[model samples]
Target chain A: MAHEVTVLTAGELRGLVQLDLAAVDVVERAFAALASGTVVMPPILSMAIPEANGEVDVKTAYIPGFDGFAIKVSPGFFDNPKLGLPSLNGLMILFSARTGLVEALLLDNGYLTDVRTAAAGAVAARHLAPAKVETATVIGTGIQARLQIEAAHLVRPFSRVLVWGRDMAKAEACAADIAERLKITAEAVADPARAVAQSQLVVTTTPAEHPVFKAEWLHPGLHITAMGSDQAGKNEIEPAALVAADLYVCDRVSQCEALGELRSAIAAGLWQGGTPPELGEIVTGRHPGRCSDDEITICDLTGTGAQDTAIATSTIAAARKAGAGSTILT
Target chain B: MAHEVTVLTAGELRGLVQLDLAAVDVVERAFAALASGTVVMPPILSMAIPEANGEVDVKTAYIPGFDGFAIKVSPGFFDNPKLGLPSLNGLMILFSARTGLVEALLLDNGYLTDVRTAAAGAVAARHLAPAKVETATVIGTGIQARLQIEAAHLVRPFSRVLVWGRDMAKAEACAADIAERLKITAEAVADPARAVAQSQLVVTTTPAEHPVFKAEWLHPGLHITAMGSDQAGKNEIEPAALVAADLYVCDRVSQCEALGELRSAIAAGLWQGGTPPELGEIVTGRHPGRCSDDEITICDLTGTGAQDTAIATSTIAAARKAGAGSTILT
Candidate 1:
């Protein structure tokens, strides 16, 4: 049988997909499907290349109603910056759900991952953040720091943004970029605790091996989205913060227990409540996300294959409609 | 930094690689690397799409000293034949071990998997099959049946082959194909027991849920390579047959126990010996493969990710040298 696969470059994907409300809705639907318990997502297959200081993770999910499923390959090489390259990049391959044939190769160079991840934060904020927000804080100086702030602004029209990082210069640069891009008041804060205390919503986006957000800073009406702890040995929130929060949610319960803030919380003996509700449950209205403005909420976003599948599926559809990629016959 | 990936179609891969001695050697080296204990191979990530009567598996391994590693995606839709589509088709993506950047996209549509799987059979026969073999039998009239006979011929130089299957007509067709392809005498036998008793080497390649090769047919100096059982609930050899053999080896012990013939053997309470030696162990000389020609041997080939990495690395290298694929820069 003749087979054809559409190949989209990162440049084309950037033109096709953005961190907009539509992207947020697509990811939100994925969470709802995940809540339906029909999404088949396996644990990630990861390999570490110690010699090169690199690691690669393969993730996939099969959503029942989707026309296609996506298998995403993400690689993180810490030392790549030394070679004047970004530390993280990879691609996703979409296959026909019925025929199991190749449909598209999404060479997004981690752009889709970035958008999906940030959109997940937006979903969390849309469901769990305070009704009124004047200030938002992002605890990192990475690409996600900017994206998370932009995503949060889409849900909650926060006027002021604070960027916090260990490196003050990078933080200042990031804050400047956000200010120029969003045309809002943005500042680089030296202290994360003060930033969290003042902001109504906080998003952590660092690859820190220790907590960057503290429990003492988590105040009433504040929602924290911790997204950097997607791998073992990485943490961005204090374990006690989960215990202090009125409602603690996860992207996926099992994944958070292994690779999210819940791991550290369990390890520190701070998490006594077993199996927290997932974001999907909240999205499906099975669990109330935030009952009151005074309640402190935290959402652990470890990212998921369902999000990748949803975003890839949507991106390919858009690409096909726009005729944005080259097709190769096999 | 600019990134480039080579995309090789199945036709290009077929032109670059073949079911030959070199392929066998590459697979043999992978076995050796696996036994060395440095190959980082994660458990396969699989999902069942019951709605489509299909299943997809993602397998990857990082073998040290290799420039690249392959992540192979294999999809099997059992009902595809009705739609005039092959049941199995997929692709592999090879990534740079150093930079974690994609090196190649192998659109082989399961062709490389076929060659590597057949080469593994040849590796088993080379190590376990007795010398001076005049007749060999294949216990299925599938693609692997012909490949197994041809692969074994590369090692044992078997003069005659017997093809056995449930359908006599299909068996005769496979036998005729093998006879014409290899220029050797081949026959289709209805009696599986008689075929086993007459042959010095036998390779079972059926996806039967129950045992297809009986223990009573075991004869001295016969080497049985069971390559069919790579998933749970699929067994080709009777459980008692494992106990009847003098020596039993595996491509991978844990995989075999879960997905290969050994799963049935253990369930039948017949496998008393704990943790049998692997094919890699035999390749590395850690275990004597065949003590004597009179000893009955069984090697369970459940396949491995290491072979995929090895074959993919070699294929890409050959493709690069031959300039056989299109390169896309991202």
Candidate 2:
């Protein structure tokens, strides 16, 4: 029998999905599913074309009970920006779990990745950050910087957002976008340490080759979301900062050790704790998150297929509900 | 700038590709590229959905100078046959190596895989088998049994063909198809040894869990192409037969040892020859393929990603020339 595969575009997805707590809940559910012991997630398939300064990673997870699973193709070419194309772009192909037949192709051009990643950050912060976050700082001027801060506001309703970047012009532009979108006081901070010291929640979204924030800047009642460092050799926070944190949780502990900021901490011997519990453990109540307002907490997120599958699931459903995207028969 | 992605269907691809020496050369080129050591192929990403008895593997390779690379998704559902669906089906996604943008989506539904696999077999036989081949035998009665025979006839026009299968009825039907397609005298042989002794070149394409052919059946001046056992623990020839052969080669030594017929041969301790040279080495004259007509040579094939990329490259070009598929924008 022939099948019609639903195809949704990035614009259609953005128009259908609102950045809100509901998104946070969807990601949180994925975390719980990850902790449920029935998800079969293979190691990511990563191939690099160094001549082009590009790499593509394919990630997927098959949750036994779900009707669908997603395979995400994420391509990152550092030189793309010089050619006026975004540095990151790719799509997701979702298949039926029962028959291994493709159900839909989500050509969101990384929109779903951005959405799920932000929702994951917000969910992590909600469980680990202080009850009330008055200010949030994001240390990057990329699309992720603005999106992560906006996602943080969804969880805690932060009134102020501080942005920092190597390129001050991009930083100022990012801050302006945040202010206009959230109707909040958004400022471009020249000093990352100052932003870290003043804010209750800090989000690191840069593709930093070295530490972007210092250990001396961490405060007692602070929570940090390290959204960068999804690849090896990318770091955001000083190892000493991780050592100082009373609670250091990762979106997925194994991934953090292999591909996130926590890898550097472990290599530096600053994070000596025996396999820190995952963010999913806390979300599922398998472990307690933050003990007190004064306890420093850090969540190192390297992203996961579970989150991608969840967002793809919800995105396709919403697209169908709104009658969005084109349909092609196969 | 946005790009339009070409989409080709299985029927279109089947219509465009003719099994011949040109196809054989395409696969041979891929083998040469693999031997050249410039191909960047990551470990296959495989995820299993146990409840459904299904598994999906994604394979790709980036040849440094190619304009595009292919990511092939191959899905296998053991129970699909019972549901009136093929047990294996999937497609390949081709992307621009320079910009990391999708160049095309080959919805060939495993047609490209089938093509390249058969072509590889024929290529191996061309370089390894004796120049004069009058008769050939094929084990198994599925699509591959017919395709492999047709593909082999392109390289060496055999006047007679022998077909063998576990089911005699299917074997007779397969022989009938071969006779009609190749305009040759084809017979369904009941005895494996009789078939081996009657043919100059033999091809085995079964999915046997245990050895289906034995060493006692080996004939002097004959070459065998073991195309089964692409996955672990599947065997076609007796380990003793591999040991009896004077020359043994594989498409890839590492893959053959890990997942092909050689894996079992090594386990049974019937073959202890140190890592055999790959067929590409002989193709490039790095090693001589056959020393004499009576060498009793065997070629164990465990397919590679290079073949997938190469076939995908040509398939897309052919589809473009034929105007055989739809176009979608991303």
Candidate 3:
């Protein structure tokens, strides 16, 4: 008989200690294992569902290298407001590889994904961003913007955080929350251009189809982590941004080409050279990272199966140690 | 705040009272959606990981029609002792196409998978098998064989069940268990040929490297559901059986080519004039099913993603209704 399964509710996940800085370490470790080919990573399979005058996208990726699957089910409704709920509600499954057991149940709907994605930002910063970066500018003041602020602080202690959302009040609230929680000075900027210009380390977390950040806003030695633009036809950075960068890195080269900032750059014939080094290759020391202090670097993270597996596995272990789950045998 | 998540353990799944044949209904619906081009089902992706001295295989499939993934993570350890554990262990994820929300988590490990596979058998029988079929024979006496029996009972009332295994005692014990639980008279047959020759409906559920049942054993007006031969070099029915059958159906053409008994038949040039209809195609009415009672139809159920999605969704819903999980807020 198997032990009782532990259920981690959305409320429970929210109440659990924010896995901010520590989660970065966990993601990094998982990537390192992935680079060494120690992790079991599965491919991403996606389907497009055409319903009555509408379509929904469903994608599933196996991260055996991490031992879990990150399934993204997104429904596009032109009338989401009429439904009184957000258009997107996603869930992830983290199953154990050892015994083929589902050790932990994560029911954040989408909160866990947002938080873990922010945690990835922190992980990328520790490895790619410059040390002791003082300022962080985040585009988009949605739920992810707040998380990016908290997660960015885990790697670099920012004295000021500038945010730019579609709405001024929303951005202001995001900055205010970060300021109150982390004791960092937070300011809402009127324009994305100004926000990116103000900070040496900029994070783009918007769902804008148009280019929100331009090359003119980027400076030498600045490290930009493009957090949004995860799907096709969604781009947050200008094409010039790719041409201006001295170094470019991506989570997965194939995926980034189809669904990240690379999509726009490639479409504009700006991505002339070979594919950027995989984050794993950089972590494994196969490719040099940040060759010069003055060279501008950009890390494109569209998210991958490896990250989902890592976070899910780590959370299960933590939940078990904390006596957080019940065991029931089958 | 999100609702408290319910955690359903394997024990809870085992203790489930209403297994809700609704999953069977869901699969049936999904198949109909499939043939009409209303459903999009992609081919499965498989990755082989070579260990220090052994190798492990990871198989993944996306069923757009069902909005779910059926992932199988099984050990390649063909050398391990059977210590009452099946070699396959993994959980299926069911994502709601309506909201892209994961509606349920079914942690049957492999038990749910076994039942679902059997349910597929039931699904196949509803469409392909002869109506009011009386005699049935099961090739192997493993746990999968038990499921096949139970699932078959759902479709046709078999007053007599013939069982055969490598070991005579195990086969007799299986017959005893079936007789006690299903209240049907199950008789153990000493030889595989006897079991196959006697029944109008036959299901082979063994992990044999070579064929166990010969073409000579099969009679006219028979329906053979080849449940085994899911992997390369694992076959239960002879290639001659393919030549003898008047109509043939498979789960997925690409998958069957690599792992099912279809591999051998295809290799031997036995798949001559007609292309075998997919089980989904038959379910969706794209292809004719069982035209005549004596048509000698055969449904090769290698299993597919639709089955997995249906079961996972149904299991999770059942778990939730029973209050089978605890709440953990993160």
**TM per candidate:** 0.99, 0.95, 0.81
User: What ordering of candidates by TM-score runs from best to worst?
Assistant: 1, 2, 3
TM-score between candidate 1 and the true structure: 0.99
lDDT for each residue of candidate 3 in A153-271, tens digit (9 for 90 to 100): 88888899998888999989999998998898999988777766667788888878998888788787688989887778789889888878888888777778988999999998888
Clashes within 3 Å, all models in order: 0, 0, 25
Q: Compare the candidates by DockQ and give the number of the best one.
A: 1
**In candidate 3, which residue ranges exceed 4 Å CA deviation?**
A45-94, A166-169, A208-211, A214-218, A238-244, A263-272, A325-330, B4-30, B40-104, B131-134, B179-191, B208-219, B229-244, B252-275, B280-286, B308-330
Q: TM-score of each model's B chain?
A: 0.99, 0.96, 0.86
lDDT (CA) per prediction: 0.93, 0.87, 0.69
For candidate 2, give the DockQ.
0.70
Candidate number achieving the greatest lDDT relative to the actual structure: 1
lDDT of 3 at B83: 43
lDDT of 2: 0.87
In terms of lDDT, the poorest run of 10 residues in model 1 chain B is B1-10
